[model samples]
Target: MLFLNELLDELQSGDYFLLYVLVSAIAISVIFAIIGTIVSMNKLVFIAGGVSHASFGGVGIGFLLAYHFGWKNFIDYSGPIYSALVFAMFVATVIYFLTRHQKRYSDAVIGAMWALGMAIGVICIERVPGLKISIESYLFGSILYVNSLDTIILCILAVILSILFFVFYKTILSMSYDEEFASIRGIPVNLLYFITLQFISIAIVLSINFIGIILVIALLTMAPYIMERFLHSMKQIVMGAIVLNLIFCICGLAIAYQFDMNTGPCIVVFAAIIFFISISAQKVLKKA
Candidate 1:
């Protein structure tokens, strides 16, 4: 383990941002691991994708308000972030209602919403007079943009989410695999679903900066699913996912930095490699 003084020395060095990267990765891993487990358990991976892209609408709205309407303070003062949260929650709610009884059509509906949000974001961004950042930053993760503020926000969200997971541990576990049974046990199944999906929305919005919307689903589902093949309990699955995500993010960032590559896609490629390897392991272990 890194000693405190040594850690402090490293933080003060020229590569201080490395600390930011490490913290951001760990915090995001914690949030994604827990959320991913719930998402995979409930089989809402596609909906999660919809929610992730839906956040782009909020991001565009945020930039428009800040640059077009003089809400610059509002944008960074949790404006765009909160707007994305609201937009994502709205999309998640819509998906829930639309698919509640129309299971056969959920995919089509979610795809429509997904495209709609990205379109809105693109159009809104086009109106910003002097936008400095590229849309790809939001689309494919921007390593150069990782800073102290983003790291702090991620840390705060991670703590809040961890607390929530603890408080609703059993309820979530029960609902994950069997919502009907959870409802039979008097757990407000619908309410929990709405609330959890909302949480997932905010997570995606915040995580956009680190991993981008394009790869959010993989971080939020692939690791959890891979762990499921070996782990039997939710806690173990989440823990294993945290470790797996850390590996993907850290290794991806290192490789990206060394090769001048896009951070988001690099991270996802590592995940894809691991996912395939896990498939092989699953087959081999099954025969064992």
Candidate 2:
């Protein structure tokens, strides 16, 4: 309690940048919670991973084109963010079509794609002469570097995701449990799958700044998975996960601020500890 009070006091006295960071974190956490719940229940966590890393290819493409065309306003124009969105959506669609038939080699194909994206990004980045892109930020995350633009993007996404969930909650829940049954009931299984993947891609791209590509999967999966142990209904799981995500983000931000550490790792570490405890408690209950 004392710690939280101190943190709040500091934020009250801090600059506008700190306030921006807090807002961004909350918005991103909300999006992640809902999207993560969908990804978890639909059993598409692996696809989320593919989309997250595949966004780097888009980043690389943005830089390659901007540098080659002498576009000096890449930073001001959000060139990289657009490229990532497009690239992530494309990859998500491709993965969906390729793996829809449940081929033995589907996982292999996604793995290849995962590697190809990183490889392409590295090559493109290396080809850009005098380019000084922050590869570390993309891979490891840099929440402190999130600007107003990023926050706006995340806020819009959160609104859109919330509406989608509310409008199609029944269909989405049915699909998550049984695609075959959903199709039998005339639900457009393929379309819902595609839309889900699209949302997953967007969430992953936006999350790069807060959790980075490497750790974004963990952030998206672990919280909901923890909530799942105590909740049977999908709605309950999502609501619980959102609360847990906010807690992790706030606590992590406070710790990072106090120690001058990276916010992404701090958040993930806090989540990891909770996940461990949840599993341990479940085991103990089972034994009893």
Highest lDDT against the true fold, candidate? 1
130, model 1: CA deviation in Å? 3.2
Model 1 Cα lDDT, one tens digit per residue, 206-276:
88877887888887888999999998999899889999999999888777777778888989999999999
Displacement of residue 120 (Cα, Å) in model 2 is: 0.5
Cα error, residue 135 of model 2, in Å, equals 1.2
CA lDDT for candidate 1: 0.85
**What tens-digit string does per-residue lDDT give for candidate 2 at 1-288?**
434666467678874566667787778778988999989887888888888888888888888888889888884225676788899899988898889887677788788778888888888888888765577777877765687788888889988888888899999899989999999999999998888888899888877877787888988999899989988988888888888998888888888777877778888999899999999999999999
True-vs-predicted CA distance for residue 276, candidate 2, Å: 0.7
Query: Candidate 2 overall Cα lDDT vs. reference?
Result: 0.83
Candidate 2, residue 147: the lDDT equals 79
